[model samples]
Target: MVSITSTASLANALRKTIVDTQNQMSKAQVEVSTGRVADLGLALGGGTAQDVSLGVRSADLSSITNSNAVIAARLSTTDTSLETIATTAQNFLETLVGAQSGAGSDAQAIQDNAVSGLKSLIGALDTSIGGVYLFGGVSTSTSPIADYFSDPPSASKDALDQAFVSAFGVTQSDDAVGSITQSQMQSYLEGGFSDLFSASGWTTSWSSASDRATSNRISLSQIADTSVSANDSAFRGIAAAYAMVADSGVTKLGSDAYNEVLRTATTTLSSAIGDLTRLRASVGVMQTNVSNANDSLTAQQNALASQIGALENVDPYEASTRLNNLTTQLETSYTLTGKIQQLTLTKYI
Candidate 1:
C-alpha cells in the first residue's frame, strides 16, 4: 500500500458524492409524489412550453366538469314540471267527459268541476322551474291563462285569445284567427313557448341558456304553442248553446244541440289529448337525451381522471425500483473510489 495521506482527501470527496446522490434521490421521491419533475427545464434541459401548456389544459377540463354538473340539475327540474303538466291535463280531460254526460240537476256541479279542472290546467301551464316559466312565452313574468269565468258560463274567445297570445307570444298572428281550434291554438302556443327555450347546440348545459355552438340558440325554456283557436271557437259555441238550453224560452236542448255539444267536447278533448301526448313523447325523448348526456359526461370525466393520473401520478413500485438502482450505483461508486485510494507501492516495498 502506498500509505498516501491523500486517502483522507479521497474519502472526503467520495463522501461528498454520496451525499449529493442521496439528495438527488430525495428530490426524485418528491417528483414521483407530485407527478411533476421539478425544474424540468433545469433538470431535463427541455420542453418548458409544453409542460406549461398541459397544465393549462388540465385546469380547463376541470372547469368544464363543474359547469356540466350545474346544467344537469336544472334540466332535471324542468323535466319534473313537464310530468306534472301532463298528469294534470289528463285528469282535466276525464273530468270534462264525466261532466258532459252527467244529469241535469248536476249541471252547476259539473260546470264547477270543469272550471276547477281548467284552473288546475292553467296553473300547470303557468308554473315555473328555476324562475323560468314552463308555458309562458319568452316572458316568464306573467301567467299564461287568466280572465276565465269558473261558474255558470264559459269564457269569451277574446279572453282565450289574449291568454293564448300571452302564453305563445307573436307566433299567434292575426291570420291564425277563427279557423283555429282551442286545442290547435293551445298546441301552437305551448310549442312556441317551449321552442324559445329548446336546447340549441351541443354543450354540457347552462341553467338560463346553453350554446353548444356560437351560432345556435336552442331554447330549453319554452313549451310548444300550437293553434287552439278552433277549440276556443268551439267552446264559445257550446257555451252559447248551453245558455240557450238553460234559458226559460227553451224547454229542452234538441237532439241537434245535444249532439253538437257532445261532438264539440269530444273533438276538443281528443285534440287536446293528442297535443298532450305529443308533448309527453317529447318529454320522454328529452329525458332520454338528458340521461344519455349524463352518462356520457360521467364516462368522459372518468376517462379524463385516468388521463390526468397517467400524466401526473407516480407508480410507487417503479419509483422504488429506480431509487434502489440509483442507491446501488452510488454505493458502488464510493466503494470503487475507496479501493482506488488504497492501491499504493508502499506495502510492496
Candidate 2:
C-alpha cells in the first residue's frame, strides 16, 4: 500500500520550517553582535552547572575584596592620625628637653607650649574618618577624649586642679604652691599623677571610649583589629605628661618644683614616643597583610572570570560566520515558503 500526502500538509510543513529558520538566524545575529549566548540555559544546557559554581565563587571573592578595601581605608586613616600624634609628641619632647637645658629658660613659655601640645594630642586622638571616630575603639560614633576647654574644663583638667590644691594647699598659680617641698611634688607625681593614666583613672578623667578594639573581616575566615583607642597606654602617658606641664599650679611653683614636674613630664613623653612608634609599625604590618590579601583575591577573580567566559561567552568570529550562513539559509527558506503558498491543486494534478 502506498501512502498519500496532501498539498495543504506540505505547505504547512514549509511554513513551520521557515519560521524556525528565521528564529535561528535572529538568535545567531544577536550572538554575533553581543559576543555572548542569548540564552545560557539553552546554549550550554547541562554545562551551566560549572558556570553557576564559578559565578558564586567570583561573587564571594568580590565581597571579600570590598571588605578589604574598607578595612584598608580605615587603617590608613588610623595610621595618619597616629603619625601626627607621634610627630607632635616628638616636637613637644624637644621643647621639654630645651627647657631642661635652659635653652629657653622661660618656665611660663614652656608651660604654654606644653598646654598647646596636649590640646593637639587630644584633637588627634579624637580624629574621625567618614563620620567614624578612629580612636574610639568600638565606639565609632563617640568622640574619644573630653574637651579640655569646655565651660567647666574636662574631668582630666579638674582632677589636676584638685590634686594641685590637695598637694600644695593652694590654687594652681598662687605663690604658696612655690613653697611646697620637692619631696611632696615627687610624691604627687608618683602617686596621684600616675593614677590619672591608670585604666580606672582614664575612665574617670580623660576618655569615655570603649576598651574593646574595633575589628574588620578582611577575608573569608580572618578578622583583624582595625583601630587603636585613646585609652592606649602610649596615648594616656602622653596626655599625663603634658597635663603635668600644662597645670597652672606646676607653672606657679618655684623653679625647683617646676623643674621637678618638667623632669617627670619629659620621662613620660619619652616612653610615649617609643610606644607610639611601635604601634605605627604594627599598623604598617596590618596594611601589608590587607594589600597582599587583595592582590590574591584579584588574581582569583580574574581566573574565575576567565572560567565563566569559557563556559558562557560566544566567540565573535565563529558566531558571525554562523550568522551569515543562517541568513543565506533563511533567505532560501523564505523563497521556498512563498512558492509553497502559491501551490494549486491543478499544478499538483
Candidate 3:
C-alpha cells in the first residue's frame, strides 16, 4: 500500500507542536519572573565557570565581613573595660597621693581602697562575651586573672611574703619593720619586690593569660589584633601597685618606711594609667582598620555581583516579549490541532 496523508497523523503532529510550544512558553515565563536564566547551563555554557568563581568570591567576602563584625564588637567591649580599669587606677592613685601628703587621710582607708580596686581590676580583666573570656589573649576559654586576695593564700601573695622575708630577714609584720630605714625600704621596693611584678613573674603567679594576643582576619590581605592580655605590662603594674599597698603590712612599718612604700606604689600606678591609655588607643586603631576592611569587602562584593549579573541574569523585558510570542504560537498550535481532530470523512461529506 502506498503512503497517504491521514487526519489522525496530522492531529498527532499538531499535538506534538502544541506541547513543545507550551514548554517554551513556561521557560520564558520563568525568565521574566526571576530576571535570571531559567537554564544556566544552556544560557552561559562555557561562561558558567566565570559566574561560579564570582559567586564563590562573593560568598567568601560575605563570611569575612560577618566575622569582622563580631571581632569589632569584642574589641569595642574591651575598650570599655580598659577605660573602667584606668579610671579605677586613677582614683586609687589620687587616694594614695592624698595620704602621702599627710592631708588627714589614714593608711587603713587607703589600704581598704586598694583592696577594692584590685578586686574590681581582676573582675574587669576577666570580662567575657558570648562565653569567651576577653583578656586571655589567644586563649579565650579560661579566665585571665587570678584572685590573690582569696583564701588558701594565692601564689602571688605567697611569693610576696617569701621575697619580703629574704630581703629584710623577717616577715613584713615583724616589729623589725619599724627599725628599717627609708633607704632599706626603697631598696626592697625597687629590687626583689619589683621583680614580683615583672612580666615573667606576672605570668608565673598572677595571670594565666598568654602573651600571644588574639587576631582576626578582617579582609583577604589584612588582619587586626582583637584582644588584650591580662598579663600585659600595664596590668602587671596595676597589680603591683595594689598588692604592695593592700597586703604589705603598712600598719606596722615606721613613718619613713610606710611613706616609701606609698611613694613607690603611687608612681607605679601613675605609669600604669599612662600605659593603659596607650593600650586602649591601640585597640582603637584596630577598630579603624576593621571598619576599613569591611568597606573594601563590600565594594568587592558589589563588583562581583555586577559581573555575575552580566553572565547569568536575563533582561525581563525581552523575556516577557518572547513569552508573549510563544503564547500566541501555542494558541495557534492548539487551534490547528482541534481543527485537525474534527476533520473526519463524515464531517467533510
Candidate 4:
C-alpha cells in the first residue's frame, strides 16, 4: 500500500510539472512568433494610443500623396492649354504677315482671321477640366472669358474690351504683350505663358482694369526680362494695336504707317506669346519638383510602415525553435519531478 501511494504521489507531481512547463512553452511561442506579446489587451491588460497614432499618420501620408497626384494632373492639363493658345497666336500672326493673298480680299480676310483667332483665344481662356476653368484664378467654376456671340460686334467691342479688362487686368494683359513682335509670338508663348499657367496653384488678382492698375503686376524676373513696367503706357500698346486693326484705311495709309502698324502687331503678339510660354514652363518644372517630393514622402511612408510591421509581424521559425526548447525543458522537468517524488521514505520502508 505504501509503495502504491508513493508511486501515485510521484505520478501526480510529474503531471503537475509537465502541465506548468507546457503552459510556459505556449506563452513563449506566442511571444516569439507574434512579436506582440498581447493577444487581446482586454484579457492581458490594455493597449496604448501609439498604435492608433501610427495608423492616423499613415493615412495622412497617403492623403498627401493623393493630393500631389491631383496637382500633377492639373499641371499637365494647363501645359496643353498653353500650347493651344500659342498655336492660335502663331496662326493669327501668319495671317497678318500675308496681308493680302491675291486669291482673297485682304482686309476682310485678315479681319475674319483675326476674329477667328480671337474666338479661339477666348475659348482657351475659358477652357475647363472637371468643371474648373483653367484660367479662372481661384474662381475655377467661372469662365474667364465671357461669350460675346449674342451681341453685334459694333455694339459689343467696348463691352468685349471691358470684359477682357475685367478678366485680366490691363496691367497683366499689357505686361504679357509688352514690346514683343508678332513674329516672336510663338517663341514667347512657348517660353513664357507656358511657364506661368502650368504652375500647380497659380492665381492672380488682375480680374479687372482697376485691379490691373493697382495689383496685377507679378514680377517677370523668372522670364529673362526684368525691365518691364505696369504703367498706363504698357496697356496703350494693345489699344494702339486694336485701333490700327479696326481702321479700315490701312491700304490708304502711306507705306510708312502701314509698316509701323505691322511691326507693332508683331511685337504685341510676341510679348503675349512670351508670357504664356514662361508660365507653362514654370508649371512644368513645379510639377516635376512636386512629383519628386511625393516620391520621397512615399518612401518615408514605406519605411515607417516597415518599422511598425517589425513590432507586430510574426517570425514563425524563431517561434518554432523557442517552442521546441520549452517543450524539451518541460518534459525533463516532469521526469525529474516524478523521480524525486518516488524517493519518499514511505516507498523505501
Q: Using lDDT as the measure, which candidate wins?
A: 3
Cα error, residue 57 of model 3, in Å, equals 1.5
Model 3 weakest lDDT span, ten residues long: 102-111
The residue ranges of model 2 lying beyond 4 angstroms of the native Cα positions read 1-30, 328-349
Give the alpha carbon lDDT tens digit for every residue of 190-286 in model 2.
Answer: 8877887898999788898888888876766678877777888889888888888887575667778778888899999999899888888878988
lDDT per residue, candidate 4, 1-349, as tens digits?
A: 3535565676777787788878778777777756654353433333335555666777877776676666566667766766876787777666666653333336545555655665565566666778856555455565644443335443234433443344334422254324334334334333333222222211221121111211111111111111111112222222223333443233443444445545556576666666656666665766666666677777878987886565455567776787888888887876687577657666667
- How many residue pairs clash per model? 44, 1, 0, 43
- Worst 10-residue lDDT window for candidate 1 reads 201-210
In candidate 3, what are the lDDT values of residues 145-226, reduced to their tens digit? 8777778888888888998998889887788877888898889889888998898888887888989889888998887687
Candidate 4 lDDT at 220 equals 15
lDDT for each of the candidates?
0.46, 0.84, 0.87, 0.51
- Provide C-alpha RMSD values for all models, in order: 12.5, 3.1, 3.1, 12.4
Winner of 1 and 2 under TM-score:
2
| Candidate closest to the true structure, highest TM-score | 2
User: Candidate 2 or 3, higher lDDT?
Assistant: 3
TM-score of 3: 0.86
Off by over 4 Å in 1: 1-75, 103-105, 136-263, 316-349
lDDT value, residue 346 of candidate 4: 69
Q: Pairing residues by index, what is the TM-score of model 1?
A: 0.47
